[model samples]
Target: MKIQVLFFGITTDLVGSSTLELNIVDVATVADFKKSLKEKYHQLENLNSYAIAVNESYAADNLLLKESDVVAVIPPVSGG
Candidate 1:
């Protein structure tokens, strides 16, 4: 299935785009998507402090993903 992924802060810079299409396998969840992304983009491994939103609302890792859902990879704030 296809999902919309948004990158924020460092994630945007690392990904080089604020938004992109994420291709996911069958019966996937937020955690599953993250695993796939981590495999392809090792930088994601360093961003474990972010939150995942499903359809504009924050959700847990086990939250099931939908074809039309928008998944955002939000990096934690680190301004000091």
Candidate 2:
């Protein structure tokens, strides 16, 4: 299955792009996707704090990813 993964804030720097289409098999949950990302995109490991959005809204780690799902990594905001 193919899914779209998006990166925001500092996550864009680590993943080096705003988004990418990924081909994965049996991606049941966000945690599973995170593991794949940790291995394929090691830089993401350092970004422990990020929100995952399925299609557009924020979702839980146990949420499943569909073939046409759009997952975006939303990093927390920081400012004075």
Candidate 3:
């Protein structure tokens, strides 16, 4: 199975790309994808917090992922 991942804010800077086409297993979950990302992109692990949105709404770690699912990596926001 494969999925499209969208990167936003600082996540795009850390990942060095705005979009990623990932090849994963059929039983992958949101958490699983995140773990894989942290393994491949160690910079993400240093972030204060990271969030993921599936489809359009914020998703939990256990949320099941599908082949065509659209996952977005939402970086934390900071302001003065």
Which parts of model 3 have CA positions greater than 4 angstroms off?
Answer: none
lDDT, residue 74, candidate 1: 86
Candidate 1 Cα misplacement greater than 4 A, ranges: none
In model 1, state the lDDT of residue 30. Answer: 84
What tens-digit string does per-residue lDDT give for candidate 3 at 1-80?
Answer: 98999999989999999999998888988989999999999999878888899999999999999988999999888899
Cα displacement (angstroms), candidate 3, residue 31, comes to 0.9
Candidate 3 residue 3 Cα shift, in angstroms, is 0.4
Each prediction's TM-score versus the true structure: 0.90, 0.90, 0.94
**Better structure of 1 and 3 per TM-score:** 3
Position 73, candidate 2: lDDT: 86
| Model 2 per-residue lDDT tens digits across residues 1-80 | 99988889888898888889998776569988888887998997787588888888889998888888988889888889
Model 2 misplaced stretches (Cα beyond 4 Å)? none
Clashing pairs in 2: none
Q: What TM-score quantifies how close candidate 2 is to the native fold?
A: 0.90
CA error at residue 5 for candidate 2, angstroms: 0.9
